[model samples]
Target: MNRFEYADNKFSEIEMMIAIPSFIIGVGILSLPQALASATTAMDGVFSILIAGGIVTFITWAIAKFAASFPDTTFISYASLIVSKPVAILLTFLFAIVFFSITAYQVRKIADISKQYLFDQTPVEVISLTFFLVIIYAVSGSRVGIIRLNMMFFPFILFIAIIVVIFNLNWFKFSNFLPVFQSNINDYLTGVNKSLFSFGGFGILWFYMAYVNKPNKAPKMAALGTGFPIALYALIFLACIGVYGESVTASMLYPTVELAKMVEIPGGILERFESIFFVIWIMAIFNTTAMAFDITVLAINLVFHHIPKIKIIFLLSPLIYAIAMYPQNLIEVSAFETFLNYAVFYYSIFVLVLLFVVAKIRGVKPSE
Candidate 1:
């Protein structure tokens, strides 16, 4: 069986950053602020954002260091070259499971949110199935096609989100953020721990670095990608806090959407502004799900030495949908969130350590 080949030289660093970060920013933008506010006091949520951003930035730098050293190898291949084959395969399987589970959890969250906010009477299975179909279609496309699709959709999503932010500015109360850092320091630390899950998708860069047309520029592009999401997340977190006092923000399930509901245009043409926000959010979610599907397809092709056929993509969809169905309630989903927090923390640390050890073993010098 022939291994699937990426079009040997396609994506520029800027394109890679655009595709990768658009995938990471989805649920994080909408849900993380509320989670942070609940874990810490609203004032401390800002501090938590700084901490989360620092941790992610440092870890991303380490991953880029490793990618720069190898230049033209995927993480799967690098694992074997650095470690023994057995260990490499074991690690790859572990990461595959992690990616699959994360994908399922995100899909499930999208389904639940859609049911509650957008389609109040729609069945969860139907909603999930519909999105699952879309993801399969996305994954079946060529790599360039997926990249083009992401670039096209991301700008519109950002524009709508910015409009939502502006329209809702009047609802913000500066007093809501007055008692910054008044909460217990432990709460702020815990909030940072929780927010790590929001930074999960950036690691996709580890796999894509191998395919980056300009390997020399990968590190800078990776940094830009990582920094962009962190900045966007911080602003969104502050917006949530400003609109909803820490107490109320902490209590709401989807505080960002709730804040959008509070948006009122001066002209009073529409009563519900949240629907507009939701449209953009749906696009964001699509980008994320497509990214996960893309990575999974790439990994499968590498492992099995065959291009992913359309049938394989179709077959995988129902499996993902099934796994997504297991989270029976919000509590179960919260458990998954907790699991994701620790998983990302440890994964980041392991990848950094492994990268350093590999670089020393390989005797790789830093790139100019």
Candidate 2:
């Protein structure tokens, strides 16, 4: 790709397939077991994960179809045609805030976990600042650089997830998952709602599909990408339940992290696995943060075309840092995350549906 091509576009179907899952499976994975356990039984959580995954996949496909309809144009561009330019600008800024909010959540959560598991003596301010620096460096380069980072690190992410599951097999009890369907309709609804929110990151496809080499293939690639996190979440949920029981998993703050703590290497190859796990897991979180940051910059650039991306990234870093540090403690962090959960969910539906309906009404044809 030449400079012009690289500047204009940065993703292919395969890169997108890798990027979507990498974006989706970040800090949320750490708390997924607790989220699922709180709403339903161990077995019920497994079912809820699958159900929620399917729903999210369909929503993402819908967003992809909307993007495909306006090939070579981003949500920010087409939305202006559907609505007024000022309205699109306002909504774009609002959505950029949402993305920034998630990046904040990731940095805060990663810092919290690092303090608890890996750096008991280190200050969270120091850890978060360091992590933020890495995120800035990742986003400073082309979006293609970030996409390649995801593609390279994805396997390590999977390896750690599978290793966590495999190493916990000795503690697994079949009876822990017994008495399935113990929860009522309300319980299932609550569990599915929580699980469904974890898949919120897929909404990035709205902004990203415009860069796809084959925009026509984006829906299928995105659908397949969605499946990775679903299967990974289900397996992790099952593993947590089998090892810790539903009650225990629900009570614990980070059940998956705890699951890593439980692994006992026979030869004492590495005494502490959770630290190793967190090291790998933090990179996955970085992928999530960088993608969110990149989109926020992209959104801003859509309105102010003269600003360079590098400068925008530098200008936004402090605001993101401030947001990440705003939460005083874990309770406040959880409250913020819950707010983001519902916000992303409803906002995504509104944006996708509005675009699709307006496109049809306006006779916006899908490109050849």
Candidate 3:
């Protein structure tokens, strides 16, 4: 990752921009309403989501600007200049570990959900292995291919999400907002901390922005890309409370998917709407896993310079599988997810801020 080598597959700021939501909107959205419901009352979750989104957006913009400042250089390279090489290398390894952990978490989550909804008879291990295999194929390809995949899948994801929200209008009860803002600051703070992980994809900006054709435009476009999901999640939270009420939403596992279940086509053409939602949502999850695992590969490559990229993927595949299968039941799975949320919060927010402040104090300027 310290190498400044740029391949021919550099992308436009637009592509980089769209990749944000493509990464941010995956597995997190499926269960956010439930998490928010338990933490905040009524429509108050909307404020928590907005507040978390704002925090993520600001950090994404600033860190992207900082990463882009070094132009053509990887994050590790610039960090080594600001802090010593050994420290930068350690930081990169930790970054890679967090990404790897989240990748495993996403793999396990998809397998568990798919088994519940789509493949009741199939083993979770089988589903997770198959899913990770495809991600391996993706990571083995050109990096731009992953970004292009994000671009292709994002529109369908967003369109389906919006359709779910719009079709659920009949279920809305305006009285849901009657108890607005009833939650105290602690509730809002708790809710915001819980929801912030959904926007954690911003952490990818450090490595990804190094490939943007126009680094100067990185911050604005990154923020704009994230804006889409912030609105989408807040709206989905509102739709969940509106359609199902706060108590019911809190009781359910996947309220957003439930919203899809309630959508009836005008002509009765589309039955089992949640099926389509699951299919498209898998695409979103794929984007997340591929980008994250790719970064894991990049970070490992930085350490083992002589080893090939394909070998790294092969070496890590079994470890990810083991981690995915380690969670025996729902309670353990939830605990594992909470661990990831904290890992991501620390790396994405705290680590990025540390890098930014250190770079400034040391007066490390970007290459002209």
C-alpha TM-scores of all predictions: 0.91, 0.96, 0.96
Best by lDDT: 3
Tens-place lDDT per residue, model 3, 1-368, is 44333366798999999999988988899999999999999999999999999998988888887788788888788889888799899888998999999899999999998998899899999999999999999998889889988889999998999999999998789897669889999999989988898888787887787788898988899999999999999999999999998999999998888899999988999978999999999999999999989989988887777999989999998998899899899999999999988888777677677777887899877767
Q: Candidate 1: minimum summed lDDT over ten consecutive residues — where? A: 1-10
Candidate 3 colliding pairs? none
* RMSD (CA, Å), each prediction: 3.2, 2.2, 3.1
Candidate lDDT scores, in order, read: 0.75, 0.87, 0.89
lDDT of 1 by residue, 105-186 (tens): 7788888898889999999989988887877777776766677677888788777767777877888899988876677978
- Alpha-carbon deviation at 77 in model 3, angstroms: 0.8
TM-score (C-alpha) between model 3 and the true structure: 0.96
Compare candidates 1 and 3 on TM-score and give the better one: 3
Candidate 3 achieves a global lDDT of: 0.89
> How many collisions per candidate?
0, 0, 0
